[model samples]
Each structure stands twice: as structure tokens, then as C-alpha cells.
Target: ELHLHTDHLNLTCSTFHDVHMIRWRLAIEEFGPTFHSVPGSSNVVADALSRLPITDEELEENPTVTMAAVEAAMSGEFTVDMRVIAAEQKNDKDIGESEEREIAGVLVLVHPKSKKILVPTRLRLRLVQNYHDLLLHPGAATMVITIGQVFYSRGIEPDERKLTDNYLACLKAKHPATRYGKLPPKSVEVCPWFEIADDLIGPYGRKRFRALTIIDTATRLIEILPATDATSMEAAYLMDRYWFARYPRPTRCIHDGGSEFKREFAELQDNYGVERVATMTRNHQANSVIERVHRVIVEKIRTKSINTQDEWANFLNDTMFAMRASNHSMLKVHRLSWHSDVTCWWALPTKQIGKRSINAR
Candidate 1:
């Protein structure tokens, strides 16, 4: 189907009788620049039409105008209202005949049999109809931007207002307040605040006797919750309240299964729309965020704050600030931008000019 040019490899002086070039469109008296080069397809028509500059008045007068008129409409000047367009669907040679015949146009795909290709400039834009449903929520902001213009349509697309509403809606939909996944991709809540991370950070009686510490995973933003009682429920209550006032209730609270981190502390997640759980077959490295945060506090805050505290208020406050100031690669996912790939952390709205102090050490 290459311009019906069969002898593509035949390089010889052409006999006039062998080359019968047929006229495509008599209206195209002068063949303008070739915007596209799919020689055997209708993409040439689409490309030419896209370069046109028709005004609304002209559009009203020539709704059924020729492609040449479209080229005239978009030449040199630009129009904002007339710019949105959808992706052109190219068909394979072996496609079923039952499908709509797609030429150079906007597509209305009802089904395989119900689709029709309309004019390119007359399409509808929309929300991200491309990302997986699971990733269409608040934390997954990249999903929206990734598919913002996807399969570009010309219809009314979601505006900034709807965009925010969509985000909140997805956030509420996925939060544990509504529903939580209860299996492998998400496991069961084992207890309230009792997540176990065993670290041996003492030289009291012996050289290195370890303290098998169990911490409330949720509220440990403040590091040390009171461990006066052997059972962790009392401590879990204090930690649970702190987080209840902040983040969306966690679904799976994780830690190592130590005696103190065990018991019924995981249920605090349920009361505050969370789920607590412990790791069975591993060490402190399993609940490493807490352990890491702990070591950092023990090393830095113990020296900087210039005090040791069984009461964790001071220790926890500085560590919380440090964690926020620190960069996390998982939290700072990246994607292609107009200029370059930008991490999500950098893209976040900067704190107001005279607001919070940022310590990114």
C-alpha cells in the first residue's frame, strides 16, 4: 500500500508507462509542506489540518469545509479553544472488518463495533483514564500528571477544581477509615502499639547487654513513649492518640514480635482506624525505621539536646524534625518534567516564605 509504489527496490530509468501517478485531491492545487511522511496513509491529511487557523465565525460558516480550508485556518496564528485533540488510532492490516474505519480524526470509541473516527480538532479531554485504579489516590499524585494528556481528547477535561476534589475523593476512598486491605499486599493488625524492635544499646552491668525494646510503631514520631507497665497497651494508648490527631490511620503497623511489643497493642489501629502487627521471623532490622531513627537520636540528639531522657518528649520532637528534614527516596519518587526528571519531594509546595524552618541535613 506504499503509494501503490510496488517496485520500491527497482532503480532504473522509469518507462513512462510504468509510473501512473493518480491525482489525490484536485482542491490541493499546490502541495504544501509535508508535515508527516506516512506516504500510504491519511496521516498527511491530519497533519495538514492541524496546521490550520480557523476562527469560530469561519467554523460556523464552514462546518463541512475541506481540509485545505483547515490548513488556511491554522497557518501562522494560534487559537487556544481549538487546540485539544485525541490520539489517532492506527489499524493493523489484519484488523477485523467489524471495527469502525478509522481515518484521520477524533475517535468515539463505544466498543469495537461502535467506534467512529471524527475530525481531529473536534475531541473531548478528560481525567487520567489511563493509570491503574489502585494508584489513582492522594499519595500517587504522579499518576495524574503522568496521564494528564493521555489519549488526548477534546471534550471538557477535569479542571483544577475537579482535580483537587478527585484527589480528596481518592484519598478518602483508600484510607483505613473506609476500608483496609487485609492480606499479603496488606497484612493483619497484630496488636495496638506493640511493634518489637530489639536493640542492645547498653553497657550498664556488662559490656553490651541489649535492651529488647518494644515500641508503639504509630506514635513513635516522639520516640520514647512511657514503658512503665510491662504490657504495651498503656503505652499504645499514648502513642495512638498522637497519631490520631495527624496522619491517616495506618493500615498495617509493623515490628518484631518481642514480649513487650506483643500482647494486644495492635488493636489501637482499629479504634483509630489503624492496624498494628509484628514481624515473627526476623531481627530489629525488620522494624528498621524505628531502630534507625532511634540510633540517630541516641547518637545526635543525645549529644545536641544535651540530656538523657526516660521521658521521650524532647528526644522525639527533635527526631521528628530530623525525619521531616531528611530525604527519603521512596517518598521522593521522580518523573519526567518539561525541563528534566524532578523528584516528588522537590515538586511539593514549598512551605510559606516566613513559615517552618527546613533543616535538610
Candidate 2:
């Protein structure tokens, strides 16, 4: 045993003298005044104590959990709330989203195993900041980084290409000067069956009819199901079936808080076992793909006097194919490269030309 105080209650050097005296007298009395080996260390005792978990490795691996680490976490000495950043779950198809997050790009992702948040490397951050300033949003400062060609950050993915291009088009759009602090997104790629983004596409005439579109973030594939009524409960039931029939039970689905998305989707979390992520309201940057699609509709929709939804639907059939073949600047692949929708980050990929030998000569 290690003792800091003596039994006699002495406060000074007197205790040290008394302790040495007692030890000597006891040794002589117990050992019959004979010389003997004096053990300087207890190897057995040290080994037993060393077997307990006390290092960071032991704590992070989550091996045999100890009450002490738990107490430390509870007391705020160790932040063990790691469940929030386990990795952005993926699906069968993977993508190379950026390294740093854009505005409103916040979502779940695999965080650094050692820290709560991680940002793009210094070089990458500088590169993105420069690209955005010179080529697009001059005030835009960062881009997301990825792990093994994939990842996620905390905010949203704006039409970085469009924003930049539009600014440069006229060099005078009187862009907004306001800015907001935001969470940094993590680098990640998509796999399959873990993440999904869905949204409703209507209010055209306000008869309460809507189209609930859910997409596999990994494959970039889309599933559009029409909801007869625009209520949340009805949309939820229909979407649940559409999701379960196609996916292998997803972990999370992103949506808006529109009355359709908010009607108790979480309780379904227990039944279907997937969490719901609602992007910021009035913030289309988070759901850039769909919003961009809407813009395409707005720009290209002919004001022609074709007075039939049936005729419009027939013509719209070709829009999907056209958008798919076009390459996207952000994802660096055609919208159809992985999924069926017409969407991309930058201007659609430019078509290349080839020359042929003239036969007339």
C-alpha cells in the first residue's frame, strides 16, 4: 500500500523519521535480525492493473466498455457522441461529390474517426476558393473533399457552375452580398440502399395533387409516384411502399417539411427502419438536382398554345433522354450516366466533333 500520511498525525519531517524507525524495528523483529532479499517492485500487481482499458485505442475500438470512460464522457471530459458521424451510408452506385460542402449541403456522413468534424485539406480549400471567386461566386470560399472518391458535408450543393456562369454571362446580375456561417461537409461517395432524396413536384393548380419523387443518391436513379391527395399521411404510405419494394431497407430518406413530408414519417422509422432528413425550407440549394430540373422546365417550357396536358406529357417524354446524355460539371458524369433524370451541376457537357476525309478529291 502507498501511504501519504503517517498514523501519528504529525505534519512535518517528524512523520518521515517515525515511519523509517518503525520499519527498521519491524524488520529486525520479524526477520530475527537476519539479512534477507528486499523486493523493490511488484511485477504481478503491475501486470494486473495494466490489463484494464485506459488508453485511446481501447476507448475508440469500443472493446469491453468501462464505467470510467462512460463517466468521463458523461462529465464532458471525453466526447463519445460518435454515432452522428459514422459515414454517409452508400448504395450500389457511387459518385464523386466535392470535398468541402456548399451552402445548405449539410447531411450525415462518415466523420473523421478521431474528430467530430473534418474540412477539406488546405490545398483543396484554396483551389476551390480561387475557382469560385475567379470563375463563379467571387465571394464563395470553399468546396467539399471526399474519401476514396466519395463523401458528404454539412450544408448544401448549390448550382456552383450556374452561379458562376450566370455571374460571368453578363458580368452584372447585381448578386446578393449577404453571407451566412455554415457547417462544413465531409467527403464521401454513394454505394446503394442507404441514402435517398425525395421531394414533391406540384401545386400547379392547387387541387391538392402532387408527385412525390424519391431518388437513390447512390445510383442517381429516380422514382416518381403520384399522390392522389397531397396530405402527408397519404404520401407517406405510398412512398413507403415504393421505397420498400425497390430498396433493401434504407437507413435515411431526405425530404422537405411540406405537409407531405412532416406527417409522422419518423414513426414509420420504427416500421421501415429509416430516418428522415428534411432540408432547409425555401432552400433549394440543398435539393439542387430537382430544383434545377424545375428551372429547365421554366426556361424551356414553350408559351406555345398547346392546350393539352396529354400533348405536353408526350413532348416531355423526350426531355428525360436529352438531359441524361448531357454531362454534368459537378458530378462529372452525364445525368443519365448513372440515373435517368436530366440534371447536372455545371453546363451540360459540350459535344465533341470529328473530321472525315473528303471523297470528292
Candidate 3:
């Protein structure tokens, strides 16, 4: 019966003239005969034939995930609420509730869910500082892993490229000064006095808040003078009290040609024997260090202030401490200390200010 069926199929094809046999087609069949005699690696037909098709059922039974995906999933699984963890971490009782919430928000975005999220006290402080203070913010994957290494017992890798792309998207609406660029190599050390000076603006409750920022060009150290109106007199006074009082007179100061940095501010710098070097008009890159630091400050304020009673003014000291104690990427050192061990210094550093300072209010 099988032989008859085969003959019938051949008859059907021949009768319909649908199957045409070319003499050249036999050449392919001849090569097939020699496949086994050739090396498997070199035998293209043999190699192709050797591969068994993987069924959809097999794929469904075992899903393959990459290292980056695994880390991202883990980050979502392990989260710690800083409010509950702060006291145990020996953090200042008044570490700014808004700041804690802001930090929590940041950590949560990186880690959405957690299997066993630990609310480590001291460990939390270390992780937060090391991630932010020890180094500049990393991509989502590294940030997750770096924080996870200290807190989670498991891997916490996120999709680094995706996270980075999202972060860049956040900056899309920022001022031109906040755009990304390659940092220039430092030619000279920026001392306490001689540094880049600028002002950043952010939302505080219903009103707008402005901060005077000075950053060491060489070390990437940041100092937040105070929250005040972005006026020349306020800038000069804050610089005199918070800046010049502790640090030696700066050799020079670099700033954008903003009106607030002109007029009285320029005269004030000259009076103190500090040369006023302004960047080319509208060129923020000339003072890129401070410009970058300003973004950080604004983000920090935005994080802590949203839906919280804490105003940006209240958290300036804490924010400044975090920035100063945090590690700088370019200088490869902590602005506040050169020592590897600077423990709990951020809890309450020198010149501790009230939650509401007279200048800020």
C-alpha cells in the first residue's frame, strides 16, 4: 500500500507538471552524499541539519534572562524606608524628614520591589553616602549593584542603559547649562576661596527658592552658602559670612555674567582682592563644576520638598553636608576629608544650623 501511495503521489505531480526536476538540482544531492566525509565544522549543510529546532514550549518552560535584567528585578524587590531606618542607622534625629523621603524616592525608583528589604541604620548611612558621597551618581545598573552590595544579600543589577536613558530624559527640560558634556582636566586646585560661584533656583512650597553655590574647580567640592533672593547684596553677604570667614581670601572667583553676579558682586570681589572672572556671555560651561553642582542641589531640594512640609531652606545644611562629605569623581576624593574613614561626620557637622535659619527665612 505504501509503495502504491508513493507511486500515486509521483503520478499526481507528473500529471499536474507542478514538480519540475532540473539536472543541476542533482548536483546538490551529490554534495549531500559527501557531507559525512567532510569535517562537521566545515560541512555547512551538516551543521545546519545538526541543529534541532527549539520548541516554543521549551522556551516557555525556561525563560532566559540577562545579568542586567536580573539586577533590575532584584532592585525592585529590595527596598528600605529611610524614615524608619534612620534612627537605627544612628542618623541625626533631625536629618530632615523631607530629605529622607527624597532619598527613599530615589532608592525606590532604582529598586521597585524587594524580597527582604532591610532597614539598616548605620548601613543605610554608609550605602547612601558611598553611592552619592563616595562617587558621583552612577547609571541605574551600577547604582543598584553598588547600593545592593551593601544592603541586599542578593544581586541588584538594573538595566543600566535604560536607566541612563531615562535619567538623560529627565534633564531634557533643564536649562542649557545643565546639558551633558565632557569635563575638562583640572589645571589648578580650586582652594576654599578661589572657586566657581553661581546661583540655582528651585520650587519651595508656593514660592521660589534660590541657593548660592560655590564649588572647588579641582576637587569638585560643593558649598551651599544659603537660601536667599538671587540678588547681588545677598550673594555678597553670604559669601562674606559663610565663605570668607572660614576660608582664606580667594585669589579669584568665576561666575556667569548673570546680573546678580555683576554690579555690586563684582565690586565686592575686587574689594576683597578676589579677581572676578566671568565666563563668556551665556556660556555656562566655563563654570561647569558649579553648574553641575547646582543641578544636584535642585534635584535634592525637589526630592525632599515634594508633598512634604520641609522647605528647601531647612535642608540646605544637610544637603551641603551630603555634598561636601560625598566623593567627587574628578578629584577622586571627598571634599570634606582626605581620610578613607570619615564616620558619621554628616550627622551633625560644624556650624550646625537650625531647621529654619534667619538668612533662609
Candidate 4:
């Protein structure tokens, strides 16, 4: 019996799935040789023969074979025809009379200012996909900048955005560009002060004074009261003096779940028959109405008390006045003006019809 030792495991197997391997096995089996497995290190002669380099004389003698091997290696690669790209650029209205340049023996259109090669309309998407895959799928802005560094195309940014938006792999890996959930239902209030939102602004300035900010959801009227601390007692006292006493008690009072809004402050709401709606933990959007106003108030205080930060409480009245006078984006009227309409109705002692008495105080 003839024994053949080799490193190739597939050659040792008598059963073959491939057509060529089966034919090879049948021809070798006719000789009735026993196949033996050996380690690659032990098969030095076969390994050396497989890795043998061709001589210059042998390559010169077999030019056709060398050309066929090169063609086989490049069969799977994508190649752009510069002539076709140049022809398409002339027809593309968006490209509109761009300068042409000969790059690497190929005529191509180029951006006038940047002097980078301009990709044609037909290949723009394909070019973006290739670069995106090469870069392991980056964000749209990154891909746009990277591609723009070497190559350019008109409306590339939008094209890249569209391509990435539809890519399934990217969709799975990246967070959505827009907010996910549906918008929260809007709270509807028929009368001014029916629903109000309240929040505490600070611990700002050297005095560490905190302010209770209350806003009427219907009229957009804002009321601010400065205090030494943010305790429940102080919050309740400030609200009673500045908010509860000044306006009708809001049916629903929305606020954050701060320590200052518990115990005494909650009891104050119960006493007035006002429903206290505390926002979810760490979720400020539940009380966004008053939260948005916090930014404006802080900005105003910063501007007014630039030198002496301890005097921030002194600017509370001025900040409230400015906010009241400014046009409300949602209401489309001054907050004070909208509130004056309700105040006038309350002023009239009798329900008898009389001359209008709206004042912007």
C-alpha cells in the first residue's frame, strides 16, 4: 500500500461535496493509496513548493497567463469610467459649467474653489456608500466632511442624510435623529389661574436666596417671590403672600417633587382645595411651562445685578414686570394685558353691563 502524507485535511477525506474535489478524489483513489495527516511544520517540502516564487524569465515567457491572473484578481472590484462621468456632468444641470481637470490621465470635473474632484450624479450615491462602508458607517455630518475633504458633489449633504436615514444597519446601531415618543397631550384651561405651574429658581447670589416662581397657564402671568430658604414653610408662606392672596386659587397646581413642596406646602394646597400635581422624578418636561420661564428670569437677574450678585433679590420686581409686559409667544398678547381682562371682570362689584375698565398695571 502506498502512503501519502500531507498537511491538507480536505485531501485526506474520501467523501467530497465539490465537483472538482470529488473528481480529484476518484482519480487518486484508483491508485489505492492510504492518506495520512501531518502537521504543516512537518510538511516543509510541500509548503515550500506552494510558496515558490516565479522567475523573471518564466514571467516573460508567460505574459498571457500573468495578464489573466491580474484580471481575475480585479474581477470583483468596482471601476468608474472617467469618460462616462465627464459626459454625464455636461448633461447635469446642477453641475452647470464647472471647470474640468485631467487627474491621473483621466478627465474629470472639479469644484472651482476647492479644486477637489467632483463626483457625477450617477455615481454620487455609490461613492457615498463605499466611503461610508470603508469608514465603518459614520454619522451623516462626519461622512459629509470626510468625503468633502477629497471629493465633492452638489447637494452631497442632503444625499448623505437620505442614504443614512434608510440604512438598516445604521438604524439598528444609532439612536434616532428625532425625539421618539408622541407629544404629551396639551392641558386646556377655560379661565385665567384655573391651572398654574410653580417652581423654585435658586440658591443664587451670595445671599443664597431662592425664589418661588408661579405662572398662570391660561394667561401666562408670572409671579416671583424671593425668600431666604427653600423650606416647605417658606414656600407655603411665599405662595400665600405673593400668589394665593393675589389671584384666584388654581384648581390644579403643577410643581416638581422638591423637598420644599412637601408637608406644609402640600397642606397649603389642601387647605385651598387646590390639587397638587408633582412631576415625575428627574423628568422636568412634566412641569415645562414654569421651567421655561426659569431661564428668562435667571437671565434678567444676571443682566441687572452684574456687579453685586448678593443684590439679585432686588431685581425680582423688575424681572417680573419685564416678563409680564413682554408678548407671550403662545397667547399672542402681553401677559399683563391678558391678565387685566380677568382682573377687570373681578373688579366689577355687580354683574351689570358697564364701560370696559381693562388696565395694564
**Candidate with the greatest lDDT versus the true structure:** 4
Candidate 4 lDDT by residue in tens digits, 80-165: 55676677777777777778899778777898999898777777877767655443345676667666766787767788999878
Order of all candidates by TM-score, from best down to worst?
A: 3, 4, 2, 1
Candidate 2 Cα errors over 4 Å, as ranges: 1-188, 205-209, 300-322, 335-361
Clashing pairs in 4: none
The parts of candidate 1 lying over 4 Å away from their true place are 1-230, 270-273, 301-312, 328-361
Tell me the lDDT of model 3 at 40: 34
lDDT value, candidate 2, whole model: 0.42
Q: Which has the better lDDT: candidate 1, or candidate 2?
A: 2
Query: Model 1, range 1-361, lDDT digits (tens) per residue?
Result: 0122222223222222332211122111112212222343544655677699979898667654111111111122222121232232223222223334333453332224324322232222222321222121222334333333223322323432354355433332232222111112333232223343332233221122122233334223233332334455654555555444543344455555655454555555456554555564333334555555444333332222112233244434433433433323332312112113324223444342122222221
Clashes (candidate 3): 13
State candidate 1's TM-score. 0.30
Candidate 1 has its poorest 10 consecutive residues by lDDT at 65-74
TM-scores, each model vs. reference = 0.30, 0.37, 0.46, 0.43
Give the Cα RMSD of candidate 3: 23.6
lDDT of 3 by residue, 75-149 (tens): 212233555554453453422223122354433111233522443334443444335322333334345544453
Reference-based lDDT, residue 232, model 1: 52
lDDT of 3: 0.47
